[model samples]
Target: MTARLNPDLLHRPGLAAYRLSRALALSRIGSWHSYAVIATPRAGMPAMPKGYSYRIAAHMGEFEAVAGVAGVDLAVAQRRLDDGCVCLIASRGAAPVGVTWISLKPVREDEIAALYDCGGRAAWDLGLHIAPEHRASRAFAALWAATGDWLDMHGLAWSLSRIALYNAASLRAHARLDAQLVGRVQALQIGRLQWLRATIGGQTTLHLSGIARPPKLALAAAIMV
Candidate 1:
């Protein structure tokens, strides 16, 4: 997976020093832990608002519309949709208000490998986003509930997702849906070398990758999203 850095950080001075410091810290210690939450049939879905509705996009046109409303790249979303990724779009009347992506196969962007090892019965939910104006409402929760329902209808027994440790809002949202924390993942990096470790309950696995780069080059290759 390609590392995506926040553009706002690029203009700041001492970026090299900052990147080096972060890399060193991560290598010696580790990046913040990301929690893996699971959704099952027993954890019932949430009720959407009176005027809101959710459905899987039926075509690229619908996907493009939703992507436009969500401020995401139309081409990227179309590619994912073409590759069999599912896009759930939530709308009020005829206007899209929220969108989420789900995958039955492995998604490299999520950077988690264990979920895919569970055979094709597992689903991964990612890229959940709600319009700012609808944030205070139950849109997100409703979308999640709909996703769970979709998973069940498809005969999938498990739904998995990773949330950053510092994302309290997301954690609370997942908690409200009765999602169980089944695992955690952390990353470490030094120069071009990077390591990713996952702990599912008591089991742990580590993966390492990267190219050789000058120690002082300060490549920001292991940033947390």
Candidate 2:
């Protein structure tokens, strides 16, 4: 099925602008970097800022609450939660202000899978958000550090994430965590035609010539991330 664009995203000015910028940038730059970090304990994993605490959402209600705070769809959040994805929520007192999701299982984006075929030793990190008021307060870094701790506790050796080419802020944040760029992926769509290409460690690995009527769910999930 052809993926229908998420109306919620389009209707929200902030999200619409974000998506438009990404699309425009992608047309010019053509690829995004895939970053991975070994899960060994690192010194100075930032502590949760003065008034914030971190917790893993243990149920759909908690997930919903985090989603509401992050301005994301409850249904999408629930689906990820039910799929065994963990949502780490950062809250001040009773209000959640930041979230990060980690998936123990493989996460595929279009034709590219993150740390694919890793024999259960990898986790994909995505959907990180911090409230506008908290943007420069180290909340995101705190959450990322917490994610690494969680990964270490779970015995996962690798933490993986993707950064779009145009997302300078996210790129710098991941760089601060010392994530290595292990792969790059580019996707293009024109009318009903779609194409994807991936490179790992500077070598081309996945090259899809085209797809007609691409699967909507997978494409939408990729875009949402």
Candidate 3:
């Protein structure tokens, strides 16, 4: 019998606190703690691999092909489409296998929030997802290759993305790609008071959450429609 590995066990040393924080958050009794990583993907793209077809979604209807696979409904996907963000989806035959999203907009979007804004120079690498069944395949490389090609042709110099620090494997993978660490974010939520401190692009900022106030980075809920 082929034995499956417990992914968390592979990164046990670094996950104890991460898992504890998740548990605390689920229990709804204490502050949750975790680190957010700001990664700057350097100039260049991954090698294009075969076995998958790619689709780049720049508008509404185009995104529908992969919305369900990407985890957001059409409304949310359409909102992102209108925001100048692009989503690259991959499929094996007719099965959606992976997705990569990026943005060149300088303004914040309601879906992405402000903490993710990396600035004007870098295209926001909003997200990258590969179905578990395809995680071990070239789906990632193919998705990135297509994304990189698009970014290169669009005159974008680089891509900036946020990653959860507890994802050790992902962090390691990013390092292998020569992606630079741009900053770190720490946030805590307690009762009705929430706080966040971030240091990105050499600037440090703090924010207190409230219905009447937005993050210092985002003065108001972004209305792009």
Question: Per-residue lDDT for 23 in model 3?
Answer: 82
**Residue-by-residue lDDT tens digits, candidate 3, 1-225:** 011122343365337648777887789875644444444343446767766778888887777766666866677677677767888898877788888788766434342224455345557776687888888888877877877777677766566665665777776666666665555556566665667677654567877775234363521121110
Superposed Cα deviation of residue 78, candidate 3 (Å): 3.8
Which candidate tops lDDT? 3
Candidate 2 residue-wise lDDT, 29-100, digit = tens: 443232221122233245556777789985787676567566557776776676567888887767777898
For model 2, give the 10-residue run with minimal summed lDDT: 216-225
TM-score of each: 0.70, 0.67, 0.75
Off by over 4 Å in 1: 1-42, 110-118, 190-192, 211-225
What number of clashing residue pairs does each candidate have, in the order they appear?
0, 0, 0
lDDT by candidate, in order shown: 0.57, 0.55, 0.62
Ranking by TM-score: 3, 1, 2
lDDT of 3: 0.62
**TM match of model 2 to true structure:** 0.67
Cα TM-score of candidate 1: 0.70
| Candidate 1 structure lDDT | 0.57
- Candidate 3 ranges beyond 4 A from true positions: 1-20, 30-33, 42-44, 93-95, 106-115, 211-213, 216-225
Q: Score residue 98 of candidate 1 by CA lDDT.
A: 89
